[model samples]
Target chain A: MLKKLLEFLILWIIWTLLTWSLALPDILAGVVVSAIAVLLFSDLFPAEIGRLLHPRRLFWGLVYLPVFFWQVVKSNFDVAYRVFHPTMPIRPGIVKVRTSLRSEIARTFLANSITLTPGTLTVDCVDDHLYIHWINIISEDPEEETRLIVEKFEKYLRKIFD
Target chain B: MSNLVIIFLSIGLFFNFAGCLGLIRFPDIYNRLQASTKCVTLGTIFILLAVVIHFGWNSISLKAILCVVFILLTSPTAAHAIARGSHRAGFPLWEGSIMDRYREDQEGETESAN
Candidate 1:
């Protein structure tokens, strides 16, 4: 299947990058390893390879990295400020927020993004609601919290996964 | 190039130090985990990025990128697991905490079922 080949190609690229060698044996080994990995883990991949291969989805995925990295930097600075402050202003609490993303991949991606960004950690997800431990409980309203926490990432993620 | 590397290195160190400060100063395990997870991850990634910049496109840089990828994937998951585990274990939140919607939701579900 094209999906399997795509998986193999991705794995092979990573393999080559890691090895960084053009020797015949290295290339042959990468091919073998990548093939085996694809065979074993194909089912773990997103079911709709067609959707994944869509140019729009690929473009959004590429765009997501810089946006995510920028947020990470911002969050680090925010947390650093909180950590170094004399009073250590924090109002931590668990707030539940709803997510519109239907796919498992999208939901997981959102959760990971929330956790990676400073000031929030996803405690749990049940049904469409995610329980997040926020460093500063800005608002208890689920809709408001969702807007504050999930909106920025979800737009790009929806494009990529949903 | 050397100056760029020093800048990255210092920024990384600063963030790492902030994370350590957070661990000490934050009230509870959950908050501490948040600090450790986010700050340390960014710090490590920056340090790795610095390595990549210094090494150009060789195997070392590639390995650094791989490490960044692995950290990005694993650290948050690990933090989530720990936070969830601690919550389930009834690790108390800070005294200044305001809400616990998770417990309220669970209680509501049980009440409706009963």
Candidate 2:
């Protein structure tokens, strides 16, 4: 019941912001639409909301953003350099790296981070391991690969989502 | 302020162009996705950041920020879905590829499932 209410509230808030208006008709329509959405798709919502608003998680999330952006900028340059080089140097491959995150949300977040960072793109996630397609196969060791790709993001995500 | 916006816009356009170049030059689907996802996503975010800066404190800037958040959330997931689907559909990696751990893992799974 609380989950449904939360979902409805969130949807209504988003609708209100998107519309950027506070007329009575808009508010009433938002309420009606959000309620219907919650009723129809409550099952798709996450089961746990207990830690979603925790203070520590919020703090870590704030810290994670700058770190994520810095990495994105650096990697964008790296990729751009590769794109323009006289000889396109790349040794692409699918290698597996294991994640310590237990929550599905955290794992998905990690995969997305990997996809955006450096030369790695997540091909699949099987159980605890993520198969990443790396453009430059630098290290053959699985542990090293995991550290290079997953370490920086996973630690913060572990605090935020796990 | 306008100068800053132009700088961001140019950076975004350059990356977007690079991403397209990669898409055309890359050997296979997975590699193309890697290039397009990373470069294009950052490119779009930078472009949206310019929009926010240009609009200042207004509803348009707020919407631009919201678009950035949405792109950050959805772009990689879309790429991941395509890569996973292509691999499952037996899309081959480049001939010069180094390894195939996903296929190996799949074989291992079937052996255990049996």
Candidate 3:
């Protein structure tokens, strides 16, 4: 099946990257390992592989990297400033925010992204609601918080995963 | 190229130092975890990125990129697990804290149960 081949290709690419050699023995070993992995994990891949392979989705995924990187840098500076400030200003709290992302992968990705970026850490996700611990609780409204925390990442992630 | 690598290294070091400072100064375990997780993740990724930039496109660079990817995926998950564990263990927040939605949610559930 197509999913099996996709899995095999992904695994083989990782193996090649790990070994970093194209010699005959290495290639043969990689092929064998990748094929076995595909067989073992065939059920894990989503039934609809077409979405994953879509050109627009792939492009948006690539676009997301730099945006994420920039946010990381900005957040590093923000945390650094807060740490050094004499007042040690922070309004830490857990706020409930709802996410529209339906897929588990997308929700997980959003949570991870929130944790990695400025002033927010995902405490839990129950149903569609995410309890996020905010170092600086700017807005109490869940809708506003969702906009501040999840919207930026969700647009691209929805394309990639949903 | 070397200058860029030095810049990256310096930025990484600064972030790492900030993370340590945060760990010492933050009021509670959860806040400390937040500071340490984000700073360390960004710091480590920048350091690995510097390695890639310095080495160019080769085996070592590829491996460095792989490490970056793995760290990106694992660090936040680890932080989330620690935060959740400590919260479940009833870790106290700082005195100046603004909200406790998790506790409220639990209370709500119990009230409904009754």
Candidate 4:
């Protein structure tokens, strides 16, 4: 029951922010819409609502954002450099890396972060291991690969989700 | 203000162009996904950032930021799904590819299950 209310509240907040409206009709519509959404998809939502709003987790999430944005920008430049370079220096391959993040949400974020970062895309994830396609293939050792790719994101995700 | 918008727009276009070029140039599905996902996602974000700047801090700008959040969340997941699908469907890597530990792991898993 509490979960349902929390979900509805979140959806209502998103609706308010997206519409940026305080009109009576708009607010009422958001309430109705969010209630319906919560009823329909409540079971699909994550089980732990309390941890989501934890102050430490929220702080870590905020810190993660700028770090993630910087990585995205750096990777964009790297890809641009490769795409325009005459030699087209790339050694594409797939490698496996292990992650310590046990929770689904944390693993998903870790995989997405890997995909968005430099010269790497997460091809698949099974259990603790993630299969990553590397554009550059710098090292063949799995530990080295994980260190270069997963650890950077996993450290922060551990705090947020795990 | 307009100059900032133009600057962001130009940076966005450059990344988008690189993504397109990578789509054409990369030898395999996974490599192409790598290039396209990173460059294009960043490109679209920058483009939307320009929209936010152009509109300033109004509802339109907030909507643009929301779009950025959606794109950032969705694009990589979509790319991941495609890459996983292509691999499981037995799409061959490029001839110049160096390694494929994923296939090895899959084979190992099947053998152990057997």
- Off-target runs (Cα >4 Å) in candidate 3 are A1-5, A21-50, B107-114
lDDT of each residue in A1-162, candidate 4, tens digit only: 888888898899999998898999999999999999999999978776578689999999999999999999999988889888989899988998889998887888898999999999988887678888898998989889989998889889999999
Q: In each prediction, how many residue pairs overlap at the backbone (N, C-alpha, C within less than 3 A)?
A: 0, 0, 0, 0
Give lDDT for model 2: 0.89
lDDT of 2 by residue, B23-50 (tens): 9888899889987998999999889999
Q: Residue A21 in candidate 2 has what lDDT? A: 95
User: Per-residue lDDT for A1-162 in model 3, tens only?
Assistant: 877887788889989998999999999999999998788878866666666778887898899999988888888888898999999989999888888998877888889999999998888777787878899998988789889998999988898889
* 3 or 4, greater by DockQ: 4
Give the CA lDDT, 0 to 100, for residue A109 in model 3: 84
lDDT of 4 by residue, B1-114 (tens): 699999999989989999999999887888889889999998988899999999888889988999898899999999999998888889999999999988987823653465
Q: Point out the worst 10-residue segment of candidate 3 chain A by lDDT.
A: A44-53
**lDDT (tens digit, per residue) of candidate 3 on B1-114:** 799999999888889999999999999988898899889888888899899999998899999999898999999999888888788878878889999887888723543455
* Minimal lDDT window, size 10, model 2 chain A: A44-53
Which whole-number lDDT from 0 to 100 does residue A124 have in model 3?
A: 79
Error of 3 at B98 (Å): 0.8
lDDT values for all models: 0.89, 0.89, 0.87, 0.89
Q: Per-candidate TM-score, first chain only?
A: 0.82, 0.90, 0.80, 0.87
Candidate 1 CAPRI-style tier? medium
In model 3 chain B, the worst 10-residue window by lDDT is B105-114
DockQ of 4: 0.69
